[model samples]
Target chain A: MNAALPILALFTLLALALGLYARRGHDMGLEGWAVGGRGFGPILVFLLLAGEIYTTFTFLGASGFSYGSGAPAYYIIAYGALAYVLGYFLLPAVWRVGQANKLVSQPDFFVHQYDSPALGVLVAIVDILALIPYLVLQLTGLGIIVSLASYGAIDKAVAIWIGAVIVTLYIVASGVRGSAWTAVVKDIMILAIVVFLGLYLPYHLYGGIGAMFAKINTAKPGFLVFPASGQSIWWFATTVLLTSLGFFMWPHSLGACFTARSANVFRKNAIALPIYQLILLFVYFVGFAAVLSVPGLKGAATNLALFKIVIAQFPPWFVGLVGAVGILTALVPGSLIAMTAATLTARNLYGLARPDAKDDEIVNVAKAFVPVIMLIAVYFTLSGSSTIVSLLLVGYSFVTQLFPALVASFFPQIGVTKQGAFAGIAAGVLMSAWLTFTGQSVGKLMPFLPQAIKDFNVGIIALALNVIIMVAVSAVTARKALQPARS
Target chain B: MRPVYWIALIPFVGILAGPVLHNHVHPFILGMPFPLGWVSVWLVITAVLMAVLYALDPANAGE
Candidate 1:
C-alpha cells in the first residue's frame, strides 16, 4: 500500500477523540445524551440535518449511479431540495406536537396522538428493520473508504468492523450531543472538501461545467436526459415522491427534529437545508464529470467510480484528504444511525418491555445496543450481498411503512383504530415485500394511483395500501367514528 | 392562512409542471439545457413558494 497511514491515522483519531469529548455533558442521562436534551438550536439542527443528507452514498454511490445509469442520479440532488421545500410546511406542525407531548421517537408521536402502543411497537419494529439496510449502506461506504485508503493493506471486512466499533463507542459515550457537536465539524469538512474538489476536478479535466456536460452529452446523451430507457416514467416519479416523504420518516431525522429548541429552529433548518442541497448540486455534477473524464472503467465494482477517479487522477495527498472526507461522511451518519437505533431500542422496545426501567438503565441499554447494531451493520457490509442502491431501496421501502400511522396520528380525525393501523402496516409490509422480491417496481403494481400514489417508491406503496386498509376497516367497524353525525 | 401549507405545494406543482412543460415546450434557462432549465426554474419556484408560505402563516415567528 503506497497510502499515507500517518495522515489517515491522525484524522481518524482526531474525529473519534473529538466525538468522545463532546459526549461529556450528554452522558448525564438518556434524555440528555440521546436527544441532546431537546435543546438543539438552528446551527446544531443544520449540521445534524446536513450530516444525515450527505452519506457515503453522496461521496461514492451518487457518482457510481451517474456513471452506471445517467441523469437519474440527479434525483438525489433534486429530492433533497424537494424534501426541505415540503418540510417547511409539514415540520412546524410536527414540531408543535413534539413539543406539546415530549415525543422521543416517531413512534412515540404516533402512539400518543392515536392512543396506540401496538401501533407504536409496529412502527418501532419497522424502523429497526428498515434501519438495518440503511446502516449497512453507511458501513459499506466506510468499508470502501478503508479498503481504498489502505490500498488493499487492510481487509475490507476488518476495516468496516473497526469503523463501526469506533462509531458505536462514541455514540454510546455521548449520545445526541456527541452527534450534534461532531455534526458541526463534519458538515464543515464535507462542504469544504466537496466544494474544493467539485470546482478543481471539472476545471482540471473539462475546463468548465458546460464543457463537462457537453462532453458527456456527446458521448452519453442518456446521462443528460430524464426517464432514461429501462428507467420507467412511473419509477422516476414515484422514486422521487417516496424518497421525499421517507426523508423525514428516517429515525435519525426524527431524532434531530426532537432536538430542536423550538419550532422556529426546525423552520430555519428547513429553509436553510436547501442551501446545503444547493452546495450538493456541485457534488452531483462531480459524478457527471467522472463519466466524461473516466469512461469505460469496467468491472462488477461500479461503486468505485468516484474513488477510482480520485486515486487515479488526483495527487496522493489530495486523495488522502478526499479519503478522510469520505471517512468523515461515513462516520457522521454511522454514529447518528447507531445512536438513533439505540435510542429506539432503549426508549420504545426496552422501556416498553419493562416500563419501570430507570432512565440511566435505558441509556445504558442504548449505549450497549449501539455496538450491537453497528456490529450487525459491519457484518452486512463485509457480506456484501447487495449493491448500495439495492440496500438503500430496501431501507427506503421499509421506513416508508411508518408514514400512514405517523401522519394519521397527527390528524386524529383519520379515524384509524390501532387494530386497523396494525393491519394496514402488516398488509403494507407484505405487499411491499412481495413487490420488491418479485422484481416489480412499486409504481407498476398500482397503475391507477396518482403520480404521488403510483410513484410510491420503496415501501410507500405498502404504506398507501396500509392506509387504505386502515381507513376501510375503521369505517366498517365504527360508523359513528367515521361519520361524526349531524350537528 | 397557513403560509407553509401553500409554500409546500409550490414544489409539488413545479414537480408536476416541470416535466409537462419540458415535454411540450422545451423550456430553457439562459440558453442552458432544459432539464437543467427545469431544475433551476423549479428550484426558484419552490423557494418563492416557501417564502410565500412563511409570509402567509408566520405561525412560529412569535414563538
Candidate 2:
C-alpha cells in the first residue's frame, strides 16, 4: 500500500508497453530482432551504446563500491575512459566486419572470421557463462532497489521475480529494440537523478563536495587514495588496463556495435561517450557521501548505500521516482543481456548443433530461451552473496579471455589460428575459473613476487597465460587466410 | 597505425598515471580529489582527442 509501490508498478507496465511497441513495423528476422536491422542512426545507436554504461551496475554497484572500498572505486571511472579510447578504434573495425558479413551475434563474428563453427560454439558457451553473472547483477540490483523503495514492504525475492518476468516479457517481444527504446528513458532519468543526488547530498550533509571528501579523509585516513598494497595502485592500474582491453569484448557490446548504421557511428560515439562516462563521478559522489552518512553497509549490503541514503532523505513520492529509474536501469540492460544471451544460444549453440535450422526458426528458439535464461539468472540472484561489482568482475574475467583472439583477428600478421584461438580461450577461461573458485589473487598465488607485481589484477595473469598459449599454438598451427583483416 | 591515433594513448596514460602522479586528496581539482579530478579532466581530453582524430581520419571523410 506504499505510494512508491504504485508508482513502481505503473512504470514497470510502461516499460512493458514501450518494449512491445518497439517490435511494430520491423520484421522480426534474426538480424532485425537481434541487431535492430542494422539501421540505428547516431542518436539511437548512442543511446544503445551509452545505455550499456549506466546500468544497475553503475546505478547501485558503483555507489556501493565507493561506499565499501573507497578510492579503488575510482577505477570504474578510469577504465571506462580508457575503454572508449580503445573503442574509438576497435568498434568501427568490428562494425565494418559485421556489416560486410551480416553477422548476427558476437559468436557469428568468430565463426565467420575463423571459419570454425566449433570455435563459435566455444565462444557462445563462454559468452553465456559470463553473461549470466551480469544478468544476475541487474536482477540483484532490481531486487534491492524495489524492496528499499517500497520501505521493505516487498520481499527481495519477490521483487526480483517480478523484474525478471517483466524483462523477459519485453525482450521476448521486441529483442534489442525493446532495450533501445527503454534506454532512452533510462538514460535521461539516471542522468538527472544521479546529478541531483550527487550534488545535493554532499552539500546537504557536509556543506560541499570538497568539504565532504575532506571530512572522510580526516575520519578514515587513506580512504580517498590508493594504498601501497592489496587493493592498491597496482591493482587499479592493471585493472583499468585489463578491463579496457576487454570492454568491447562483451558479446552484448559487440552486439550493440553491430546495431549501428555505419562504422562512423562508432567513431562519432568514441568522441561523445567518454564525456558521458564521467557521469560516474557523480554517482561516486553520492556513494562517498553515504560512506559517512549510511555507515555500516558492509559486504553484499554495500550495494544498497545509494538507495538507503536516498530513502533516508527523500519522501515516498521522490523515492518512488528513484525506484522507477532504478527499475529502468535494470530493465534496459537486463533485457539486452537476456536477448543477447538467448540469441547466442540460438545462433551459435543450437544453430551449430542443428545447422539446417531456418533463421526464423532460430529466432523462435531464441525467444523461447529468454525465460530460461532469466530463470537461471534469478536463481543465481537469490543464492549469490557477492557484491554487485564483484559479480561483474567475475564476468569481466571470463569474457576478457576472448580479448586476445578478438584483437588478433583484426590483424592477420598476428596469425592466430582457430586452433590457437580455441586453445587460448579455453586456457584463459579455465584459469579464471580456478582463480575465482579458489578465491586467489596473484598476491596469494605467487607470494614471492613484488607487491607491485602481486597486486596486479588476477585477470591479467590469466590473460598473460592466454596470450602465451595463443602465440605458442599459432606458431605451430598452420595459418589460414584471416577473413576481413581489412584494418 | 596512424600517428594521429596516438592521441588516444594520452588519455590511457594520463588516467593510469593516478598511482604515480595524482594520487592525492589535497590540491583538489574542481572540488574533487586529485586522482578523481585528474581522471575526470582526462575524460574530457579523451573526447576532444577523439574528436580531433575523427576529423583527421580520411576513413570518415566521405561519409
Candidate 3:
C-alpha cells in the first residue's frame, strides 16, 4: 500500500464510526431503517438532500463532460437548480400526500393515491430496474476515484467492491439515519474542498475563468457555444428538458422526502437546494478548467479527470483529503442507493410476494438485501461497457415512464384506471426499448413521419407517447366517470 | 395568485436564458468575480420570488 492508503483508511474508519453511532437510537424496524422513522429535521434533511444530489458523477462526470464538451457542460449546473425550483411546487404536494398516507416509497404513494397495487408493483419494478444502472454509475465512479488515488495499485474491481462493502455495512446497520448523519459531514467537506479548489485551481492554472474560456474558445469554439456543430438544437433542448424532468423522479430523492420531519422541511430544502447547486456550478467549471489546463488528456478514462487534476496539482496529503472527500461523496449516495434498492425490494417485491410479512421481518429482509444489491451493482460496474452518464441516462429514460401515473394520481377526478396506466406504461417502455436498441428514429422505423420529427430522444418521445396513451385509454374506459357531474 | 409560479420562473428563466445570453453581457457584483454571475443572480431572484410567492400563496402560510 502507498503512504496515502493509511490516511484514506483513517478517514473511512471515522465515517464508519459516525454512521454506526447514529444508528444507536432507532429501532430495527422497517420505518426506522428505511425512512429514519419519519423524523428528520431541516438540517438533516438538507444534508441528506445535498448528499444525494452531489454524487461521484458531479465530481468526475461533470468535469469530464466540461473537459470534453466545454461550456455547454454548464447545463449540468443549470438543470440542478431548475430541478429544485420545480421541486418547490411539485414536492410539497408529494410531501403532504406522503404525510397523510405515510407513504414509504414512490410506488407506495402512487398505489395509495390511485388505489392500484399493480401500478405500485410496476413503479417498483421500474424503479429498481432504473436504479440499478444508477447505482452502478456511482460504483463505477467510486472505483475510478480509488483506482486513481492508489495510482493503479488497487484494481478497479477491487476498489469498487471494497467501497461498496463499506457503504453497504453502514447502510444496513443504520439505514437512512446512517446515510443522513454521514451526509452532514460529507456535504460540508465536499462544499469546502470543491469551492476552495474551484477558485484556486483556475487562477493557479489559467489566471481566471475568463482567461480560461478565452483559451478554450480559440482552441475549440464548439465547446463554448450552445448546440455545437455536432450536437443539434433539438437534441440539446430535449436532453435538458428530459434531464430536468427526471431529476426528482429518482427513488432516492423520494426516499429522502419521506424522511423529512415536516412539509416545511421539504420546502426549506427546495429553497436552499439551489444554494447547493451554486456550489455545483464551481464543480462544473472545474470541468471546463480541466479542458484548458489538462489538454490531450481526453479519452484517457473520463472518470478519473478530477482525481488526475488533483494529483497533478495538489500535494499527496491534500490529495488524500480530496480522496477522502471523493470517497465520502460516493459513500453517501452509494449507501443511500443500496438502502433505497433494498427498501424497494423488501417493501415492494417481498411484501407483494408475501403480504403477511411482519414489519421487523421486512426490515430484516431489507437489511439482508443491502449487500446482495451492492454485489449486483459491483458486478454491473465491473461488467458494463458504457460511461457513467450513458448508464444514468438509460436509467432516467426508464424511470420517466412512471411520470404519467404519478402526475395523474394527484387529481382524484382524473381516475386513471389501473389497466390504462399499465397499458401506457407497457407501450411507453416498448417504444423506449425499441428506440434505444434500434438506433432508428420512430419515423425512420415507420417511414411515415418527417425527418425533423424523426430523430427524437427515445425517452422524451416515449414519455409523450405514454401520456397520450394513458389519457386516451383513461378517457375511453372511464368515459362515464368523465361525464359532467349531475347537479 | 400564486407567487410560487412566478418564483419558479426565475430559475426557469435562468436555465433558459443563461446559456442563450452567456456569450454577451458579463454582469458583475461590486467589482468582485461572481463566478456564478447570471446563475447566481437568477438563483437569488428565484429565492426572493419564491419567498414572496410563498408568503402570498395563503396555502403556504402554515395552515
iRMSD computed for candidate 1: 3.1
Ranking by lDDT: 2, 3, 1
* TM-score of each model, in listed order: 0.91, 0.98, 0.91
Model 1 superposed RMSD (Cα): 3.5
> What i-RMS does every model get?
3.1, 1.2, 4.2
Span of 10 residues, lowest total lDDT, candidate 2 chain A: A478-487
For residues A159-236, could you state the per-residue lDDT of candidate 3 as single tens digits? 788888788888888998888888888888898999988888878898876676666666774555554222333344
Winning model by lDDT: 2
Where does model 3 exceed 4 Å of error?
A228-233, A440-458, A479-487, B1-4, B21-37
**Reproduced native contacts, each prediction:** 0.17, 0.80, 0.18
TM-score of chain A of each: 0.92, 0.98, 0.93
Q: Scored by CA lDDT, what does every candidate get?
A: 0.72, 0.89, 0.73
lDDT of 2 by residue, A434-486 (tens): 99889999989899999989999999889999999988988788545344333
For candidate 2, the per-residue lDDT at A109 reads 89
lDDT of 3 at A81: 66
> DockQ (Cα-based) per candidate?
0.38, 0.80, 0.31
How high is the TM-score of chain A in model 3? 0.93
lDDT of 1 by residue, A372-447 (tens): 8887877777777566777787777777776676666555566666667678777887787787788875357656
Residue A150's C-alpha lDDT in candidate 2? Answer: 90
